[model samples]
Target: MTPSQLRSRIKDENFCKNIISYLENIIKEDLSWINPAFEHLISVSSDMESTIFGSVSNCIEDKENTKHNLSDEDKGEQEYFYSGKM
Candidate 1:
C-alpha cells in the first residue's frame, strides 16, 4: 500500500509512511507466490501490530485454491491474475 492510500484508510495516518515501502515490497513478493515473504514475516512483523501477514497468506492461499477449483468459465480469471503478477 502507498503512504497516501494507507493514510486514507488507517486511523493513525502518519504511522504507515515509514513502512509503506516495506509493505509494497512484501506484497509484490507475496503475489508472486514466493515463500520468502511469509518465511521471514515473523521476524520482521513486529512493526505490524495487525494481522497483515496472516491476511496476505490467506488471500494467496485462497487464490491458489480458487484456481484449482474454478469451472471452465472461471478459468480465464486466473490468467488475468497471473499477468498482473508479472
Candidate 2:
C-alpha cells in the first residue's frame, strides 16, 4: 500500500477496532492455534501500526520540515554543480 493509504488506515479508529475484534475472535475461536501464533502476529501487527502511525504523525506534524530536508539536499546539489566538483 502507499504511504497515504497506510497512514489513513492506521488513523481510522474503526479499522484498528476491527483488527482488535478480529484478533479477539481468533483467540476465542481457536485458542489452541492462536496461542502459538498470536504473539508473533500481534507483535508484527503492533509494529506495523506503530510504523504507520508514526509516518502519518510525521507527515502531519511537519509537512514543511520534510520539504525543508529535501530542499537542503537540493542546495547541496546546487553548490556541487556550481563548484564543478563531484
Candidate 3:
C-alpha cells in the first residue's frame, strides 16, 4: 500500500492494536519453528527495506531537483519553520 493508505490505517487505534496483537501472537507461535519462520521473516523484512529506501531516495532526488530549479529569491523562502505558539 501507499504511504497515505498506511497513514490512514495507522490512524485507527483499534486496527493498530489488533495488528500488534497479531504480530505478537505470530512471534509467540513461531518461536519453536525457527527455520521456516526465520526465512519468511527475512524475506519480508528485505522487501520492506527495499521499498522504504527506494521511496526515501526518490524523495531526496525530488527535493534536490526542486532546489536546483528554484530562483535565488524562492530559495530563501522558508519551506518549514517553527511556530512558537506550539
Rank candidates by TM-score, best first: 3, 2, 1
lDDT of 1 by residue, 1-86 (tens): 89787667676646666568678887677455556668678666765645787788899999877778888767776676778964
TM-score of candidate 3 against the unseen true structure: 0.46
Model 3 weakest 10-residue run by lDDT: 77-86
Please give the CA lDDT of all the candidate structures: 0.72, 0.82, 0.81
Give candidate 1 misplaced runs (Cα > 4 Å).
1-50
Worst 10 residues of 1 by lDDT: 28-37
Q: Measured by TM-score, how close is model 2 to the native structure?
A: 0.37
Candidate 1 has an lDDT of 0.72
Give the clash count for model 2. Answer: 0
Candidate 3: tens digits of C-alpha lDDT, residues 1-86: 89899889998999899989999997778456568869988999999999999999998899877877877666556343223332
